[model samples]
Target: MWKSRKSLVELSGNLRLIVSHARYGKANFHGSNTHPHNRIYIVEKTKSPDKSYIANLSASPGQKVILRPGHVYFMPKDQTVEWNFTPGVTFVAFHFGLEIFRGIDLFDGDSEFIERPVSEDFTREARELMESSDDLGHAVRLHGMIYSLSGMFTDKTMKAVEQARELMREYAPIIHYIEEKCDAQTTVAELVDHFGMTRNSLSKGFAQTVGVPLKTFMTRCLLRKVTQQLLTTGLDSKQIAEELGFSSEYYFCRFFKKHTGMTPKAYRSDILH
Candidate 1:
């Protein structure tokens, strides 16, 4: 059953679209808050938040992440989600299997990057389009959104998925090694010595399996380490650089700018304020 339409739901018999308009009262929630609808959900946070507004949701037993206002989360259906929300948490949820693009990039995407910051106006428009009785229009809007989001992943950039778990396990020692040495000077030679793999093999194999070069991956780990310091601690750039084994503050700024396209000070200013 093939059809020429921008919307997957409009293709007729390919998929079914279900919309749920729900709200959560500000309360301390525990245990399973399960719903009967077993389909993918595109959740959008409408309305504005006052001070100290935060919500926590878990897709698994031990993993929890925050859900803030203006965050759009594309959640899979299989997750056992427990959510505790701030006062007046409204959700516009779309439920659908999205079977049309069975071979599309969603299957290869990582879950950690699910949430996106959408403008309030965009969320309102999507909510209105979804709430309207026009099914095709709603389907089209949802389809476009999914397409754009999934398009963010490519062969070179997609993160570790379930299928790559064995390889991830195999490289666990190397990842751990990188984690331990990310704050200091790390090189492929030292990594190869520790992991006992040749330079060429390690370089190409890690990139192919992990979707990024080992050097690049270690640099990212370092970036995360430094970024956390920049956010949480009151240490200045020079002190942080010295403690992290950088030769000088100038080199630290260069490294941060090379990786993130912004200096640490600028990033701290933009994020903290």
Candidate 2:
């Protein structure tokens, strides 16, 4: 028998979970959209009776991950994955974001696809949790399952969390300000004034440290908010624009098209329909 005298490590950080969507059903999804959130699938049945199932254009160049039944797969954020799912593939999917620091996804810009096999009981438990009428219980169980799945990539997950903490410790205030201002129109000059730094200095430092130009980062933040609202809300473009503090729906549509290469209506039609 093995016994521990005490806990090996105590958790001190709180990871935030933002669940954008969840579903349990058969689906035939095939696309290459680079979404803002990470995704997980607890697959049940595939069209094939053999080992081959979903064809994945994996993160590694010239590599593939053939998703099989009774496995849970984790896909990172901001990476385009070409998926070719067989017809009548059934799974439970969760589209979510995990944040170790506010406004920073732990798996942001990661390209790896992680997978682990699960027992029938585990799959059944997930299905039950998804089908439950109790929202609070469902949320709790869903979080537990996500945490358990994340533990599969223990070293990588911990390293990412630690890196986020270190980065946030230095840039939290500016990041918070950007997040606050991103829902509306934001300007680099405004950031310079608020932070009491020259435009060049702020831009260089932010880009070097954050790996994205300051203005570009702000635009991405705004774009992610716009995309989330478009997917999760039934509001029209005008309503969404007003709610998001855009000056006009015309400008909003223009910005959306400029970044996403599609109008909001077209985006919804292609993605949600």
Give the 10-residue window scoring lowest on summed lDDT in candidate 1.
Answer: 96-105
Model 2: lowest-lDDT 10 consecutive positions: 5-14
TM-score of each: 0.46, 0.82
Please report the TM-score between candidate 2 and the true structure.
Answer: 0.82
On residues 1-273, what C-alpha lDDT tens digit does candidate 2 reach at each position? 987633223222456787877777775656555556688889888876443443335455544577788999888765556666767677888778777676777676566777889999999988888788867877888888887776674355455556657765667789998887767667888888888999999899887777678887788788788888888999999999998889999999998877655689987775564
Candidate 1 residue-wise lDDT at 134: 51
Best candidate, TM-score = 2
Error of 1 at 221 (Å): 0.6
Candidate 1 per-residue lDDT over residues 1-273, each given as its tens digit: 876655333333433233322222233233332222222223354243442222224332355546666666655432345545444455554432322221112332233325567677866766676556757766677676555544442233122233454456567678777767767577889988887889999999888876667776677567656776786688999988998889999999888776655678876664344
lDDT, candidate 1, at 192? 87
Q: Report lDDT (CA) for all predictions.
A: 0.54, 0.75
